[model samples]
Target: MISPDAFHAACLGLGAGLALIVAIGAQNAFVLRQGIRGEHIGPIVAVCAISDAILIAAGVLGTGALLTAAPAAVVGLRYVGAAFLITYGVMAARRILTPKALESADPESSGSSRSGRAATLATVLALTWLNPHVYLDTVLLLGSLANTQGPGLQWWFGAGAMLGSIAWFSSLGFGARLLRGFFARPASWRILDGGIAVTMVGLGVGLALGT
Candidate 1:
């Protein structure tokens, strides 16, 4: 049986993890889009959850402290992420003007093909890794929080956080299929793309300006 202290730590970690990740951000937005498209949902969700697990583990291992000392590295990532977000935003905006025909979520669909899956995988990775906020939130904040649970309980806390990440990504990726009918409409896609473009560009500007 798990000890009371360990259980408490795990609960705390779970709550913190969910709180941090449930926000509507670039990463979540991309995941939602891919999920709706019904393309590479498994790989996309796996990448997100696995990436979070790795980052949370690193933080619990004290990499958060190391990152804190390397302000320059964070700044570099910020700018790079900003550029990528803005570029992607432009692409999304272009899609609004020149939308493609709504394709079914067939295995043979262009988006579900091997090359397309590869591109989607790359995009998800970039969306996860490039964002400086992820490092700050997952590595620094969550790591520090884990350490506070004391050595014996820190791992439990990290495990809880990891569980939270897995559950969330699974729910988001798999649950989005329920809305496939709504998104099947080209008008709905245009609206979604418009919103994505605005969100991406806004975030990019904020990151670039260090706001």
Candidate 2:
């Protein structure tokens, strides 16, 4: 029952959402790790997808332009996000130095660690919300793009963008288990941790430098 123009706008939104989201970054890495561990996958994926949906809606409502006007707010968020990324990167590096298997490191799997469901969820929330780049992407970039579709069809574009988030996070959080066999070895965990550390630190530095 959808009109051709609406369909086209939806397609554009979907493509843009995917292009912005489906990249190597801290959020994706965390989702992949959680998926592999088979711990809190549902809650984690739901949080990410829902968060994106809300942000996209905000963007489509023209909040992105409002945010763009707030240069000081953006700068503050950028520094906070950089600090968070750096801190997370340091944690990843510590995991590598500890010489424990990734599976064993997870309290959810071993039940001996201090991190509980609440703690894990907190971490997920912090990772998603603390990252200022997320706002820039979902709010400013996607919002501006959606507005360009004209007022009547912008909501369709936002809906399509939300669909993209749902599809992507679902795939990432659920589909990551397919690689469990490859990550069975401790060395794989170490390598993954190293990559994660590098990525986080690199991104943190990039944000700090504003490059």
Candidate 3:
């Protein structure tokens, strides 16, 4: 029979990963926007999956525990992350409200660029790195949680969590791509931008409120 502990770890890891990822936030929303626009898929997925795997591995290996011991450090990160997310959200909202005319579209930020592979990588790095909370949640919190599951099953647990990350992100990419064809209208951009803005602002507020 499969070890009960391993099974439990797998379930917990999967659940935790999915629970955290499913919520629409800056990263997911931005990915959706790009996927919808038929932008670079490989680099987007790479950014998401690689970041997740690295974080999950760190979590499982119990490397992020250092931060957990220091309450002040995590709190500091939370505030900084919230501010950045709010700024990002507001900018996205502005883009929606004042989308440039098709004839005079301005250059996109490196993250939103339509260039080749280099721009694609740049986008992923910027999006993932801008938010400090990635470390708090994925590294410290999840790592601490995994450490409690016992050493024997930590890898399995981490693997399940990784799967969850892959599933959620891939879905976000492909699903967004599918919708892109039908919802490529100008009005659709507004709707998506509005939704992203709301999600980002809400998350930022939640982070700031700490409850």
Candidate 4:
């Protein structure tokens, strides 16, 4: 049975978690686009939420200390993540120039291609794992905060953070269907893809420069 103080700590963690997870970023943009396209929404949401849970758990378990001791690992991840983002951005830009790529988002587009599904899965995983900001936010920040609650209550706090992750991803993924009508137009696809390309490139450059 949980005590009152532990439960209170959980509430605090939940609020903090929601505040962090609700921010706009590359992962949210990718999830929103995939959600609007109605492509592998369940799998994508599951991957993101589960990934967060794992990270949050790691943070509570003091993995942040390990990271602090191993700065080189983080540096390597930053460069690799930056490269992936830039490459994906270029692909998005290419799609804007190719009529076929733009048309693939049409309402009548078929999901019969196994390769397409695999590609989407890969992209989702990349966006989730490759971002250094995720480590900074979830592991370092959250871990430091959870430790403040003391060992007796930290796990409860982590649980609350995990719940926050699940709620935010579910709302973002499934609720994105509300924008389906707007995305139905080809012009909308062009605009969305263009924005995505710019965002990805900008983030990649920032990561590469370690800014």
Candidate 5:
């Protein structure tokens, strides 16, 4: 049986993980868009959850200290992520301008070709790994919190955070299908892409400015 201390640590980890992830950001936005389009949901969710697990484990294993010592690495990631986000935002803007790029929300009509799947996987990987905020949040912040749980229970805390990541990505990717009816309209896609463009560009600017 799990001890009360272990359970409490796990609960705190879960809440903290959720709090960090539930915010609307580039990663979540991409996942939501893919989910709504019903494209590669499995791989997308798997990548996100697995990436979080790895990051959280690293943090708990004290990699956060290494990261802290290497401020230049984070700076590099910031510029790279900002560039990528801005480029992606411009692409989204192109989709808005090019009506031909907009497609029906029907899963059957979605891009399911091999190349499309490969591209999607690559994009998700970049979004997960390139974001410096992820390192700060999952590694530095969560790691500090987990260590505070004491050596005996830090792993339990990490496990709870991993569970939180799994549950969230699963729910976001799978639950998004429920909104298919709303996205069925092409105009709705335009609006969604518009929002994505703004979000991505704004985030890119913030990251670049180090704000």
Candidate 6:
């Protein structure tokens, strides 16, 4: 039988993961674009959500334990992830503050290519894979916590976390479609991106501090 601790940890994992995952970002941007365009939203969302589910589940099952069991390596990875997250957050905040003045950002960007779906999927995959903080949160922290529930509860806890990821992304992707038309103007997009940037930066900071 699963202990009360395992159940509790699983619920915490779901809440924490969803709290951060539900926000806007590069991946969320891709989902929003697809949802608005009404192009391959199902596949894109499924891929993103499923991929995230797998990673999160793996983290809980034992991967986190393996990483965390090693004192030096875990500490090293934690700091690395923290540094990356802090840097990413600062960059996101900068983008939000100087939306127009940012010379490096492309002021005019549009894509109507036939392979947009594939490109979007690839981008989401890369975004998930490249994020070190994700590993820190999902693989190390969540994983270690989930393992505490023992075998009987780990899978269930993972299921809750998986559902959290799916629900949040689905809502974000579909909800953004309705507002796509209102964002026709450059100023509108700037505001939207600015919002996303702030959210991303805020989440990034939170990840760095493990708060």
What TM-score would every model get versus the actual structure?
Answer: 0.96, 0.93, 0.79, 0.93, 0.98, 0.65
Global lDDT of each candidate = 0.90, 0.86, 0.74, 0.87, 0.93, 0.64
Encode model 1's per-residue lDDT on 61-148: one tens digit a residue.
Answer: 9999998899999999999999999999999898888846445534346356678889999999999999999999999999999999
The TM-score ranking, best first, is 5, 1, 2, 4, 3, 6
**Highest-scoring model, lDDT:** 5
Best by TM-score: 5
Ten residues in sequence with the least summed lDDT for candidate 3:
101-110
Which model, 5 or 6, shows the larger lDDT?
Answer: 5
lDDT of 2 by residue, 22-100 (tens): 9998899888877777777888899999999999999998899888789899888889989988999999988887865
What is the lDDT ranking, best to worst?
Answer: 5, 1, 4, 2, 3, 6
Candidate 3 TM-score over all chains jointly = 0.79
Instruction: List candidate 1 segments past 4 Å from native.
Output: 101-110
* Worst 10-residue lDDT window, candidate 4: 103-112
Tens digit of per-residue lDDT, candidate 5, span 1-211: 9999999999999999999999889999999999999999999999999999999999999999999999999999999999999999999989988977788767898869999999999999998899999999999999999999966999989989999999999999989998889988888889989999999999999999998
Model 5's lDDT to the true fold? 0.93
Deviation in Å, model 1, residue 8 alpha carbon: 1.0
RMSD of 1: 1.3
**lDDT at 99 for candidate 4?**
73
Error of 4 at 47 (Å): 0.3
Model 3: per-residue Cα lDDT over 1-211, one tens digit each: 8788888888899999888778767888888876776567667887898899998898877768666777787677677767867876797788776857111111232234446667656756755765556777888777777777776877878887888998888888767756754564677777777888888788778778874
By summed lDDT, the worst window of 10 consecutive residues in model 6 runs over 101-110
